[model samples]
Target: MSEFGNLVDSIEIPLRWGDQDAYGHANNTVYFRFFEEARITWLDSVPMKTAPKGTGPIIIKTSATFLKELNYPATVQVRTYAGKAGNTSLESWYEIFDSKTGVKYAEGYAKIVWFDHETRKSTRLPDELRALAAE
Candidate 1:
């Protein structure tokens, strides 16, 4: 919970050689992928009950701010924070830092809505998920 508090969940992602851009730093788009990994990992950690039918979390919007450049041969620690939760939507924040030096590389947030695949509409979040978000 450094700066972006309550996003205590974290995962480590190793930078690959191909992640680097022509300029030698990690591609900007790769940070979004890191955030995605953190978000999915965090959500997966929360135990939830079965949904009504074909229901799952879907990201409606996402954005990231580049703070520092990242290169290959490094590991990043991605941290996730679950923000406010509404009836069917919630916001998640993320931070990517050099695992060894603790230097921040990027930060981002995502708005997620619970959706029913079958009905093709937004649905209320499961109780378990809501509880997890509250934490």
Candidate 2:
């Protein structure tokens, strides 16, 4: 975890050419995409009775802090972590950096709420996820 929170999952994604902006660097929105990819991957890996269409996780908030410029032609890794778990919410954090040199490009987090699609309200987190966050 190394002070980033409990390690949940990580993934390496190649920077695509279209990821760059007119400034020749990765656009600000790219960081959010990286975080989203990692989060989705993690969610797919977990075992839970509810699905996104049923009762599942939804991001209530998300933010990122850019540290360095990211460019194309590089493979970057995003390290995901479970920060804090409330009764019906969890904080998911991420660190995106170059996979080769391990240079951190950005750090971000998303506040996820276990939500019911029909009721359109928050629900208690799944037991599997609660156990994961306890770790």
Candidate 3:
């Protein structure tokens, strides 16, 4: 797993009206998008390796643990980090927090497996890639 020093990567997202649910807060599904945006942004900013051009990584498993509610007109700061690295997959963790208050509103994690474009099967993570992540 990569050791980052409280290195938070964030993006500003406006709560859409459609994002609301019966609970009167941003719908749970929207949080996934926020998490995705955060993770992509973080990856783009860092010197990290991505799954090759055509083939993309697939989520083997995913989970979310909601901590609190988020309302409309609020901007969320989504944060992401690489948590655990494995032979064929890596664990990614995320958190959505209030942009102003910095209070964590939701947290989630995903296990992504690399794949070969042509073979359409899962592949082991490259050793160099793992080492890069560890740094």
Candidate 4:
């Protein structure tokens, strides 16, 4: 358990040269990608059953707040945490830090909704996913 909630997962991603912009720092959008990677990794690790058409965990909303500029030649660790759960969605949080220095660089949030592809509508959050909420 951590401040954000139950520690779901963490991953280290090496910053690529293309990730940086003309300012020599990572673009804001890149942080969102880092968050997405960590979040998807966590979901994949969960041994949950597949729904119809395997449609699941669609991100309804996502946000990232930059605390510090990210530069290349560095490895960033993105930590994912479980947050609150709703009827058809769950909230997840993220923290990005320098792997070597442990200096936090960004924070993020994402709301994932369980959806049925055939129905093309939101569905009830699975018990396994709902259980991921902080208790």
- Pick the TM-score winner: 4
Candidate 3 vs 4: which has more TM-score? 4
Q: Candidate 3: where are CA atoms >4 Å away?
A: 1-8, 45-53, 126-129, 132-135
Summarize candidate 4's per-residue lDDT along 1-135 as a digit string, tens digits. Answer: 887788878899999999999999999999999998898889998889886476687998988889999998899999999998889989899999999999999999998898988888999998988888987
Task: Indicate the worst ten consecutive residues by lDDT in candidate 2.
Answer: 47-56
lDDT, each prediction: 0.86, 0.90, 0.72, 0.90
* Candidate 3 lDDT, 1-135, residue by residue in tens: 224323445577877888999988888899888877776776566564565555456787888999988888788877676665787877777777888888889888877687787888878875544554433
Q: TM-score of every model?
A: 0.92, 0.94, 0.79, 0.95
What total of clashing residue pairs does each candidate reach? 2, 0, 0, 0
Model 2 scores a C-alpha lDDT of 0.90
- Candidate 4, superposed: residue stretches over 4 Å from native: none
Q: Write the per-residue lDDT of candidate 1 for residues 62-122, one digit (tens) a residue.
A: 9999999998899999988877788998878898999999999988989889999999999
Native-structure RMSD, model 1: 1.7
TM-score of model 4 (CA atoms): 0.95
